[model samples]
Target: MHQTSSRLLRMTDDERPFTRSYIWPQYALLFAYPHRTSLFISDPNNSCDFKDLFSTLMVSLPLTPHRVRFRMIDFTFTSDEAITNLGSLKFSQSNRMPDPKDSSRVVTTTTTTTFSMAKEMARSVCQKFFEAKFIESVESKIDFQNKNSVWQLTPKGIHILERFCSRNGIQSAHVKAVIDSSRNPRQLVILERDIDTDKLHHDEQTVEIIFRRFVGATVNESLSADSDSIHEFSRSDVGVRMIKHKPSNARPYEHVFTGKATVDWLMDCCTMVDRREGLEIGQLFLDLRLITPVDARAPGNDTKFVPTKQAQYYVTVHGQQIAGWTEFDDSPIPADPNSGKSREGAARDSNSNRTNVIIRNPSWRLLYREFLKDTMCEENLSFYLEVQEFRAQYTAAVSITGDHKIETIRETLAAAYGLYNAFLAPGSPNELNIDHALRTQLATRMTRAVGDDTAMMQSLVEVALLFEKAQNSIFKLMSSDSVPKFIKHPKYGPQLRGLDAAAAAAYVANSNMSSSRSS
Candidate 1:
């Protein structure tokens, strides 16, 4: 089912069914039909208007099998005959009868103005449908004025329309029959279900707790006589063993546990029911970058945690810090008297000059965030991280190519709204200092109702771009204004310098130990 939906959504321009020239005539005819007595003016920019127009088209336009030809080949396609009669309709005053009392003149004038406006409005709506891949040209012609080219609903179009009818309780038996016959047989068993947002949130929290507990439970230890080797042993008697892993490229030795042991720990301690569930939770940890494979370049590399003894992984430094495990080697480095700077001062100077380096390292980022908090400008860093997370989700949402694409997009939009309310909205608790014009643009786009999949996707894209701009603004503000102050702070600066010196000392000690082991 997802395969089919993904293929339809990814249709290329050359594979598209409709030509640019065919859309206006068909929609103009539908809009200008004299029998459309109930037609009313609506805002072209509003999503509700688009929905109403689509519903009206579905009801008013004739749907039947029509003979079409492309590349000297005949095909039976479903479409309406509105395009055939587009030339017969006229929106000018000449089409109306003369009225001496001027009462008839008023009616003619109104009809002429309304019909012309409606035609253009319909054309605009039709273009949106084409852009959304809901309609395609029957003849696939290139000419802008090709009246011979009719429009037909693509499979994706048919699916969305069916959903629209079902959602609104609008029954069209013929349309249902067409959908049933056209739908892929394999997708019949896959019923569409509403996403359980609360469950998703709960699961995320649960996984976070599990990850923290797992990292806390596993502590660095010396499991062998070799001083260069280190292993992380579980605090509990689960007997999980993490062996020392040293890469062939002379990377430092790190503790790594087999995937099977990790899954076992998740099931035995984390209350996971089965191996499948344990493996899934483990994979979630991998996705969050809490853990990584020791042999990433191995054959058949997968991001997912494979529940096998052959697969070895290690907890990341960021994961360890977040889990409340501060295992920094506090060994002191001797001062260089000849350099005219103390060891601590040299470390501070090196780190203070590199704001990018500070943010990239989890330890430095934590300290920097603390420094910002003391300065009463922590919101800048908070907003920056929030936008970073939103950007990741936006990327994932747009790249989705499955039946759940709509659901993923909806979730991303919800996150975007939350982000705006928290940081971008006026008078928001963490209101960010951003350009007023950009803020207004976001407000306008977010305030509008999203009526359909097309509107929702479009709004999501627009919001993502605006959020990116706001993120960039905040990042620049922090880099130019706050970062320098943080690096030179009287208290946090020394602490950061200490951390850098400890890390350097630890690296040198590890290198010495490795050399002695080799000897």
Candidate 2:
């Protein structure tokens, strides 16, 4: 068992269970409670009555080399208040007493506990906490008592507290500030020391230079013929398009480029060696909001930048304005009279061009799957879809209530293990190309047998978290590596263009018919 788990299991049988599900809610409540700071007492070893400790002030003072002193009263009071306010334990009077004036009437009043009883209960709870290694005294005392010595949360306690706050969505700024200020700075030094300062600076400079060069490059309208050949679109021809705003019923044009065009420019001009590197750079640009998907109705809506010929993006207006680049003229483009194409025909062409069949249309998924099969990387897509299905199942199982909850969780666990064996386990056929550390962690979790409901739920949560990380890694692999090759494939590229052409012809025919009838 992990050290934390072993510590949690150390509680006495008479004490309340120290399981995660049981303790986290209580921890959150106590951590979030407000406590008054007390002035430093002159006598450090002052003793007090157990009941009086609840009302005693808490001191925040540096007692040791790097450790800070926190009063026991603050923790006791917070624990008392948290336990008293709990819905299950709230003080209530079940028995009614006869009224003084009228024997026929009865009065109902809330039951109040004696100070001694409340004090004892809080002390017992705090003692359990100390025994479980949640908190320790600055003086290194083994037992918890009502003394002047200060106390602080142990690493285990902080870990649980952090997890509880995250799980419960408790965004208490005051709580965070307190935790941050109280935490030992030595723990963070190792993480800070691992960062390569010079390399990080170089990366930042390179990204900034790339962004400047990319935005300043000339852009133009995409032609119908350019869709057939990825290389046919000139650097200057990869420009802006006037797309109609469906909600506002207004035409707005923005400087845009196809994903293929962007990658090509990065590889050819920016010295990017391979398609994956170029796609990663493009994704970085999308993440920073320097460029945005044209299909997205608003900025910051989409994070995944598809590196395909069909995918389009715009240089964000804010970014362009900041860089002092001139905006595209808002005026409508004059129709090409020589081509003999009507306004309706042009609209149909734009509609057909906007189709991203691979993602939007279910029918095209099979075609993409077949293409992946030919490339021997069909496992990537299969794993992605399986993880998505497992996520849906896990979500539904979590919503289950009552007696069926345990059984539902068991079923979810089965599904989780099935996913793990198929894609993540070592020596398993079709094992995924995930990080070695993640696979090893999954292996460790999967090998352990869960005995009880608490253990089962804990295992399930850990597995789900690890699976999510693996899913993300696989998704990036497919997006940056496989998807680009699939898009540029000779067989698939022509088929995609053919579908677009056929759709365009059908749209123009219907549009002309509609126009004739309206006239």
Candidate 3:
């Protein structure tokens, strides 16, 4: 390889960048450091530092390496002018910046102004958390919209956020702070005329969230108080409640149901949306008691069947399967039996299939007599699917939509899944003919300097995920706009979205109280 700049250092060791794996402990290193916020971007500004850090990870390598690259079919990571410069980012410190009214950028149609400023602030804080986690090579993009609310992170930025959230867990205020940190009216864009309640189904939980945002909860307030929610509060100051690192919305509940239908129903139940966002509630109350047919069937299953009148859905992530529900609402069975088409139709209808991840696992069962301790309602979720089982069962169940954007997304997921497929098959990225090509392409001059074969190879998967995560972080920055972006159109891909955590949950179910694994 040839080089040109004074800051760039050439490497002598051919094996320096070479690594057997880069996945483990990646999250650990990120959380340990929290002040630096430049590792998320790929900027020329941090060239020298990136070169040094590449040399560090190479010295220590994992004993057992597991790697696979899944291909997400029908996913669209590709972009034309419309979505161009959306995902793929490459910024130079130019003296000139785009004017919002410039010919290149157009707000042809006015977007509904429900965008959340707190969510935007949260993205920035998350970006900082990620940057702090990195050792070096941090490039920061503080202002996304020096033009608008779009913020970019350095590769350093990527390293910090990716691991911090993974290790420390996502805080509600962290996202809010991201929005609050960058509150410049001249630069920020929030269009708030009115929201359309008709677009959302009436949901009590949904209504609660709306009111919670408009007039958020606090430790001082009663858990059952909706009357306090009726009085108007400043949307900006309303969500604030302090945390170890930042102040956020008053109360942050783990939302079990992120579904639009469910949330709309919850909103209409409380009559909050119309009052809060200047929206009008329509005749959605009729369907409040009804449970949709699809809700009856499992995500990867056909032939919807109600779980039994005595059945109620319970959800929990891996290791916490017996914990509690993020939501307590019943899965309303839809009255219209033919309201939707067959299982095949549901998968293709992006709108319908997109949010099935919200559903609880039918396989979820409680170990009532033994480990069950808490009053918190518990249901079991496990993730044990055979390739043949997944394919044979969900083949007809999975949508074969060819939407390029969605396809691109699916393709990316496929890369990770390929590794998963290979893992059970005892396969590797090479066996699947997949390498860290996605990540290697963005090493820039600095990563290329100290990055060796192993590091480069490990970085391949890390970088690919890093990019997708960068996209996730950018959207996840704000609670209102960003949260919906990730939960709405997940980049972890759809299959991951609907993760009952069962497959993983089962693995860690009884082991929750077990001693931690020894190094």
> Residue 133 in candidate 2 has what lDDT?
41
On lDDT, who's better, 1 or 2? 1
Please provide, for model 3 over 138-167, each residue's C-alpha lDDT reduced to its tens digit, 9 standing for 90 to 100. 122332222222222222322223322222
Instruction: Spell out the clash pairs found in candidate 1.
Output: 17-137, 18-136, 18-137
Candidate 1 error regions (>4 Å): 1-353, 498-519
Best by the TM-score measure: 1
Model 2 agreement with the true structure over 1-519: per-residue lDDT tens digits: 000000112222323221312111111111111121111111111112111121111111111223235423233223333233321222111223233345466533222212222555545655645544445655555554534445555443444454334322334554354345444121110000001110111233235335545554344443331242322212311232222233332424444566766665554333222255567778877877777776776454487878776677766765564233655444544444532554346553443322333433333444466566567776776676667667776787788899879766765675575466456756444667988888768766765556667887787788788888998888777756765666678755633433444444455666779899999
Candidate maximizing lDDT: 1
Native-vs-model 3 lDDT?
0.24
Please report, in order, the local distance difference test score of every candidate based on alpha carbons. Answer: 0.49, 0.46, 0.24
Assess the local accuracy of residue 31 in candidate 2 as a C-alpha lDDT between 0 and 100.
Answer: 10
Residue 171 of model 3, lDDT score = 34
TM for candidate 2 is 0.29
The positional error of residue 23 in candidate 3, measured at the CA in angstroms, is 18
